[model samples]
Target: MTEFMFSLSALCRDSRARRGLAAVLLGCVGLVLPLAAAQAERIKDLASFTGVRENQLIGYGLVVGLDGSGDQVRQTPFTQQSLTNMLSQLGVTVPQGTNMQVKNVAAVMVTTRLPAFAQPGQSLDVVVSSMGNAKSLRGGTLLMTPLKGANGQVYALAQGNLLVGGAGASQGGASVQVNQLNGGIVPDGAIVERGVPTTYAQNGMVRLELNTNDFAVAQNVVSALNRRFGGQTATALNGRTIELRAPTDPQGQLAFLSQVENLNVTLPPARARVVINARTGSVVMNRTVMIDEAAIAYGNLSVTISPQQQVSQPTTPFGGGQTVVTNNTQIEMRSDNGSLKRVSTSANLADVVRALNALGATPQDLLSILQNLKSAGALRADLEVI
Candidate 1:
């Protein structure tokens, strides 16, 4: 009976101790979980809504008022054709079989962007670029041209004085210029004549697409939206998108989306990656990248060769047949002292950079070293050569 009582007392003490340890561990975990989820960004900064994108507007137009610096009608027949058609539209008749030598007009292409949700009579900036060998477009005026979309419908009409921020001068076959003279921009030169049809706010659900595809970010977005609004309000559709229930009416939908956009959600940490530009010998790495302990040896081998010229003449000035020059080639070679040094695994980007800089190699040599490390299974991150 005494032994039984002793054993039971020991068991009770152990049970209490175990419970205390579990409580302590749970407390530590609760503190760490929030810190891991503390880095957050606004919804508007991380995602964009579908059907709310810009539309490209393009049209062919004529740029006139140039001073003897326009396309040659003989070299660019298209410019001549365009000019003839434009003149005909303005009640001018061109005689057949007549050669025109005008140097004051240029054929150009006008481009602009029609933003989403744009209404009629709104102004947009337009860009005009010359399509021929026009010397300059400093004082050109764009004619009235209708900008069309993919549906063959005119969405805007662009026409205004070009804002050329470039200048040039030519004299006696010498020319000098600054900036670009062939391209110019006109501020608020296009008037929106029509609006593209959109299906946004049609359904009761709104979809959000992330700029970067990350599953953790998508889940976090869904969770944050749900907590802010209510349950079943938001759900993750995939790694790149999240779907949320919204109001049916247009006004309410806009207000709800505005709120959602302002709400901030935490972003997950980035993955380990390394980017290398082969052409420029540039190296870029993220913080999460690490290296395993390894040894490396780098060296350079170079050979130099040049021609040495020597001129010989006889002591007698008139007796020498002619001054003769001899050329001899000299060759030299060099090799650096290559030694192996041990490097431990690096914990962060700073340490990795320090270790790499210790080799005193050029960017091209470093490229070879990194590639070799990846091939040898020492690098832990993805090696991308672009």
Candidate 2:
């Protein structure tokens, strides 16, 4: 697994291997890997087109063929109205003032993501969600629905049986359920009727938007492109963007993109930063993160409270007898002795973690220790709480 994932890193490394940043994985355990040349990333993975993107389409529809698990019509009047309107369009008219009770039908919303460059007759997956109070959507078939885009134009038609991942059963006021029953998906359910048009800026010049905003990396990309093509072919517009000249013809431009996307360049060292997930007790740090010589005293304090209930009986010599309740509370506190230990600067994350682990610190303890080190100006990285 390591060889497969970091083969690029090994190829980009120097004559002697050195560890890079260690992002926290498996909780506190580090996902330490060699990121030899961070800038060796491919252009295709680093940037996207300026205007080419995906579009979202939504539509309101009905789900049918349920086994007595549909919405209650009286509670959701819109469901009844929608059903009535559909029936009217189909030439089925109920008599005036006729009461309608629908137990095998549910109002639902159908949604799909239309990809860029999608063509007519292309099929896309559709999501079906209950818009009314339905017990479950299991064993339901979604009716034919028209999916519309932001412009209110129908783009696709959807119809399929739902793939519900949940099941439920209820009897005598007792209920049990698994997963979610209010939502389901139909793979390849929507067929595109109309396709949205997209045009790229393939003229003489096009702009590149970096996946991340970094002046050093952007400058490196400009330099690499200029060296490969020509000095006048690439220029940096800002920290996050670069404009490069390309061939006018479609074939030439395609070949140019293929060649430039794989070129590797040495990257400036990443900034010193420590990312801490406050809720999850995970800390990740870059290789540049360092610490100064300092002394730390660590210990733990715990408090436990327990409640005990007792019943008291009173004897009233044949007159009356009564029972009374009494409560007893117990509180206990424990503290571990703290001793000062000297900590020195660490060159890599392995050394940093080893030092911290020697304290026998829990996750919460680790949080306090890092914060205290930051306050003392001993930690030389930006502490980001997330």
Candidate 3:
């Protein structure tokens, strides 16, 4: 009877230990799940509402009040013509055929963007760039320029003192400059004369367009919205478009959109891609990029040329022979031997970077290797050369 009692006690202790281990594992899983969820991104970042975008406005105007850094009238006749027209409009017309050489005026192009739902009297920032042969635009004031949209309709009027972020000095045929002297900005320098009409909610519905065309992300967005609001609140129209049922009233629609944009959704893994800048020899790759085992070899070839000049004269003085000059050139060519290197297969970004660095090649040489790897079906990513 005592033996039976001891066995029962041991079995109970074993069962309790198993239960405790299970609870600890569950706690660990709980912590991991939330950490993964925290990495999700808000809907506003991945997509934008249709018809809610900025419109580009462009205008041609003049920047005046420069200190002898304006456009030369002889070289740029447009400046002279613009000045003449402005003077005539102001009831101060010069006599016909009169040469008006102004050294304080420069022609510039003004550009700005009109935000969606912009109201009249709203102030906007404007960019002024030189359109003529002007040395600088510092200490200049932009004249009244009417910014027009693509439809050729004036939307805003820009006029303010230029805020140039560069300085330059020239003396004794030597010049020093910093940043850019040809362009400047004016903060809150433009007032909207007209407002653009936007249809935020059309027919009691709104559409969301993803910046990247990924069907998985679109579906995830719809799922997130539906789970928050209702089953029929969101629907995927295509790989890039998602339609949502919204309130018809403007106030309710605004609130609904605000909430919808704030909701977080987990995103799928990004596509593997590598971007290469041909001019600067820069290579950039995403984390999803992977490479298979491959072999690479690269070498450098150098050529050197040396020239020697020789003069021939008569050995005896007063000999009837003219001195002649001859040139001798020596050319030498050398090529460094390149050894074959093996690149191991990489499953992660860090491993891939380490493997590429082991090749001891410059970025310019890496470009050719990457292209060849892609051709050989070793690189499992899209290669884009910019």
Candidate 4:
């Protein structure tokens, strides 16, 4: 009996070892799963299906019922012409050569975006902007306007009270205004009269266009889609285009595309780049930006001019010389002493920023320095000035 108990105890020990091994494996997998998921992004965020986009619609219209702050008839004859034409359409015939100087009407341009898959009877928001020299569009109503697409076909009609998000008061040659007065938005102001046919999937295949061009990203997306669906489900046509095989039936195609879009795709590292806004003096760098060892020196030079006005009188009281006005001007110039500073090689954005900041240069100065660095082949990234 003692021999039998010893064998049983050995078996129990082996069972416990197996259980512990299983638990360790599960823990490792649990930790790895989250890390993998964290690196992935939804396909929808990275790409858009072809033939799915908004269409721009624009029209010329008029805004009426202003508080005498509309366009001047003499300055903007278009306003007068538009008003006259609209009145004629309404059966109100005005005598020829009648100088109608109405201060309550203004000509405006209406614009809006016709969203993808929009149908008739859908309400859309429209923006009305003064095409003339209208003082203000507040408390105005947009007349019946036909919004046309690029094809010169009317797709929508806009007519509503302008909801201008601005206020102003002018009196005694002094004026105070907030926000903008020449532009306003009318919510649900336009009704769709026609629909633009959109075909996302053709011949049982849907094309996906990436927001950016990257071969690595495109391949990864193809791989992700294929793995989720089946082999040969997705094929990369180029760095920015991918062909996806979808179902033939409309309902089935939508369902399949939905699943494909939700699939998680691991993205490759972004290309190193620096964007500079020349007008705003803004410099932006991505995390992958790097810099090579270089030496930079910059300085500031300023000049100041002061003018003094004085009245010179004769030494003796009224000694045949009337009071004369004289002017004296002073000019001062200054320049900062520039010093050569060595910038060490940077492997990341933080180090690059630190090295650049050490020069104590302003944004405008930095812009010039970065451009020079790019020209000198020290900046290991593309420099884009916008």
Please give the CA lDDT of all the candidate structures: 0.86, 0.83, 0.90, 0.91
TM-scores of the candidates are: 0.75, 0.76, 0.85, 0.86
RMSD of each: 11.8, 8.4, 10.6, 12.6
Q: What count of clashes does model 1 give?
A: 1
Residue-by-residue lDDT tens digits, candidate 4, 135-163: 99999999999999999999999999999
lDDT of 3 by residue, 1-386 (tens): 00101243555569786687678669878966886676699999999999999999999999999999999999999999999998888999788888889989999999999999999999999999999999999999999999999999999999999999999999999999999999999999999999999886789989999999999999999999999998799999999999999999989999999998899999987899999998999999987899987777778889999999999999888778888999999999999998777787787677688877777778998799889999999999999999
Runs with alpha carbons beyond 4 Å of true place in candidate 4 = 1-39, 307-329
Query: How would you order the candidates by lDDT, starting with the best?
Result: 4, 3, 1, 2
- Model 1 TM-score, all chains together: 0.75
lDDT, candidate 4, at 160: 99
lDDT of 2 at 318: 68
* Better by lDDT, candidate 3 or 2: 3
Cα lDDT tens digits, model 1, 1-386, are: 00101244555579786687678669878966886676667999999876678899999998989988888999888888888888899999898776788899888999999999899999999999999999898898998989998777899999999999998898999999999999999899999999976655547988888899999988898899999999898888889888879999889898999999999998776788889999999999987788787778877999999999999888797785888899999999999888787666887676688878776768898799888888888888899999
In TM-score terms, candidate 2 sits at 0.76
Query: Candidate 1: where are CA atoms >4 Å away?
Result: 1-38, 167-177, 279-282, 295-343, 361-367
Model 2 lowest lDDT segment of ten: 19-28
